[model samples]
Target: MNDSAAPVAGKTGLEFALLAEDGPARRGLITTAHGPVKTPAFMTVGTAGTVKGMTTEQVQASGAEIILGNTYHLMLRPGAERVARLGGLHRFMNWPGPILTDSGGYQVMSLQELRKITEEGVTFRSHLDGERHNLTPERAMEIQALLDSNITMVLDECTPFPATETEARESMERSMRWAARCRAAFTQRPGYGLFGIVQGGVYPALRRTSAEALIEIGFDGYAVGGLAVGEGQEAMFDVLDATIPHLPRAQPRYLMGIGKPADIVGAVQRGIDMFDCVLPTRSGRTGQAFTRRGSINLRNARHQEDQRPLDPDCPCPSCSDYSRAYLHHLFKAKEMLGPILLTRHNLHYYQELMAGLRQAIEDQRLDDFVAGFARQEAEGDIAAL
Candidate 1:
């Protein structure tokens, strides 16, 4: 996991290039301490230092240039200090590629009654061992530094959905103040970058204020947060509409925790350059397969004797060599291979979609690409051939 050997000479420390654009959609590149990531990219979530069922090599092979880690999980388990002593997150997780770590503000908010928020920070009980922990903007920076995260996300309140403009404004203002602290706490390095998150629920005015505040504090990247909590896709996009126009185009725009395949497509079209979600791998474990036309449940009886690939267009090892019948059998028999294979295929599907999006942006055909995409989805999966 050592990319420390890459020549740092002449490096601008977290450089970015906007290569192409079609409407609001963009194709960009982010240069990190470890390497460069092509955008619009989907960062596979590797919360707790692992991407669940897949190995690091498998994840890389699936076209993931970057993966995400949660500050809360790592800080709770092996402890940030322990990881630093062992050689940081990339080395500890056996992943050499770039890693982005969330500031854990969202998880702490989820604690509800188990936590208390003050002007300085949020104090919460660990879900792992019921231990008490406090997370502040400064401490968040410290934890990410200890983990040696390439992309450090700032601590921000994840405003709950359906909040009034007043409530949202207060929450968003608090996050803006924390963003200032995070910027101050983050140590500058050659290729590392800290991203400030915009939190204002679904209010356009509040979203603008939050984005403006973060931009003032400055960051290598900007993320649209707090929408995916419960707000539907349209609402999320509305926030992005109001927020992204106010963001710095020179830097990357990341839509946090957003979505299904359609959601990613929409966000990428709306100027988002990065994403992270646990849907693909999690659904795989439950016998769900994400195909071009939508998701299919392998647990269904129709798949018991259906001798076909999960997605004929898919080139993943699972689809290339396995049949729907065999996959159904694996799940029915409770074979471990089912989840592993499904996860591999799902990741491949996601990467392929990203590749297509990048190509579309490069060719200035994003509109056409999106139309064809929706048409395919509407047509549904090819009849069991």
Candidate 2:
């Protein structure tokens, strides 16, 4: 609730400007040390300094202004120290745009059987080599700094769904404490930003408390974490309705690790300004393509003879240059190109969705856009050739 703590622009290189809004929907731009990101942005996931099937250029070509890197993965493999010695992640990954590095809290939380959490930090064995490692809030900041991340997320516990109110509170409070430590440990630099994650499970009051706590500590941006993890869409929206209002309007609001096309649209409508997810790329590798008319599986025999593009309207190479039948054949044959081409198209579709949302907000027609998008998705992929 205190706007003074959160400024839209400051001496720091990371800045955000609210250009327009349609009701709760926002259209904005985030300026970082690396570059500028047009809001309602979808950051392609480059988990291990690579976007799986696509190169940095390919990711950039999909209209992505930013990409996310995983501290857990990078530190375990090539090592953050190595990345810094090689001129940071930008040069190492060949990506020159803005980069956001998560604090590894979520990944640590997922390693329930392998990790132990205490007041200081989490200690666990690396999944890659079974090597022991420690990750504290300060250490998390150190690793991201080593990677020279443009946007650094604070370390926070990703509270599991179905957690009791007491358990949620305990996890959220520890995350808040860790966030404060991250802020203290983070180095201030122009064009660089440190974001705090808001945790609290599905409880509204707890969410409010978490938001207020992060606002007090202050951050370049605020992210709502621990959703889309088995919580239904309606419940997720309800949590957003409860949390988004508490977040600073001047700074960007990111919904972490969220979700399908419909989820993004609904979150944007509720005032979320940024997002990242592995769904599009992961689904692509499995032969799933996201079209305007919902998702379709290429491995299904129904597409074996269809000559249409994945989505006739998509301008990506997979759609404009290749046919669904060919795509199907590639998947059937287990060709590597099938995943690459589909991943390209899927990323393009996600970016196009974001662009459409931004345009709708600018035109003050977000309501109409959302309705139409739902209609198209409901109609399903064009009556199967």
Candidate 3:
């Protein structure tokens, strides 16, 4: 966002310190341009430059240190070139903190009917218009640099599940090649880092190969990709169990585009240090709220006359000030406030959850924390109490 293009000072623009380890879970600190983010942090996805209803200040107030931007979305609308002209993503979005951007490869692949892939890159029709465009690994690196992202992800094919072993291997190899190009093209700055993604379907051996290949190319960080698309939790965890051990213990481990509350906790227990997901924001807009227990649908008739807050323990502005009936009324009447309040509450829950996780890891009681979490989830809504 600064767009100064001034080189970052010092070695390893970003530094990860592994302070403690309990079983597979880790407690550490990630140093970034904005500040040092505690490990096991959940980055709210502010795709297209904003986190939906919440303002940047509000997001910070909720204890978020960093946010995510989508390269594909920004590239398509407002254009990366336009954003660069306006002073990069941070200044443009008025968020001065750290920002991490995805490589735009995932969205391009999702455009199944509009895309064609080759050795060079992928050519796809813009979902917004019929306009044709090409995105290669080099182009993705350049785009992230223009965005002034603190962390940039490598452009890799997110191979979907159920593919044949041959198909999965082919896709994995392509992603590895792209990772090399992406690493070569990345601009190194102090506090800024490029991460390589590991992509292999459900095969343990394939996952190991992907991890080894990315390590050989070398990167500031590493991510476990190509999971959670359709693979159930057990399969995802199994892959993580096999893959995480192979990753460098000193570097931060990121699990991309994953998951529900349970998924986050499970992944963390399996040794993931970083995460980004659209569930909290997207589900909020659809009338869902995640509490200490499980998820709740506010659209239920049970909330019609309920006078309690969404979560009695939650300290978010929404839960602190508004009643279930008020939120329910707003949703029933199709008011924008419903989405806004729910979004805030859900983010608050997520941040609080991360805080709890970090504390648990630091205390070397992750197992106990996880056990308590399960018990609470089984206990159900606190509002009914």
Best model per lDDT: 2
In the predicted model 3, the residue pairs found to clash are 1-90, 8-190, 13-191
Per model, how many backbone clashes are there? 1, 3, 3
Ranking of all predicted structures according to lDDT, beginning with the best and ending with the worst: 2, 3, 1
On lDDT, the stronger of 2 and 3 is: 2
Report the Cα lDDT for residue 171, model 1.
Answer: 91
- Please write out the lDDT profile of model 1 over residues 168-258, one tens digit for every residue: 9999999999999999999989889999998888888888888888888888889988977877888877888888899987888899997
The alpha-carbon deviation from the true structure for residue 279 of candidate 1, after best TM-score superposition, in angstroms, is 0.6
Between candidates 1 and 2, the lDDT winner = 2
Model 3 per-residue lDDT tens digits across residues 1-385: 1112232232456887777678899877778786677779899999999999989999999899999999999999999999999999999999988899999999999999899999999999999988999999999999998999999999999998789889999999999999999988988988899999998899889999999999988888899999888889999999999999999876889999995888899999999999999999999999999987678888988899999898888999999999999999999999999999999999999999998998888788999999999888788755563
**Prediction 2 TM-score vs. true:** 0.97
Residue lDDT tens for model 2, 1-385: 1112333654445778788889989988888788788889998999999999998889989999999999999999899999999999999989999999999888988999999999999999999888999999999999999999999999899999989999999999999999999999999898899999999999999999999999999898999999989999999999999999999888899999996899999999999999999999999999999988888999999888888888878899899899888999999999999999999999999999999999999889999999999998788755762
> Which candidate wins on TM-score?
2
Question: Which ten-residue region of model 2 has the weakest summed lDDT?
Answer: 1-10
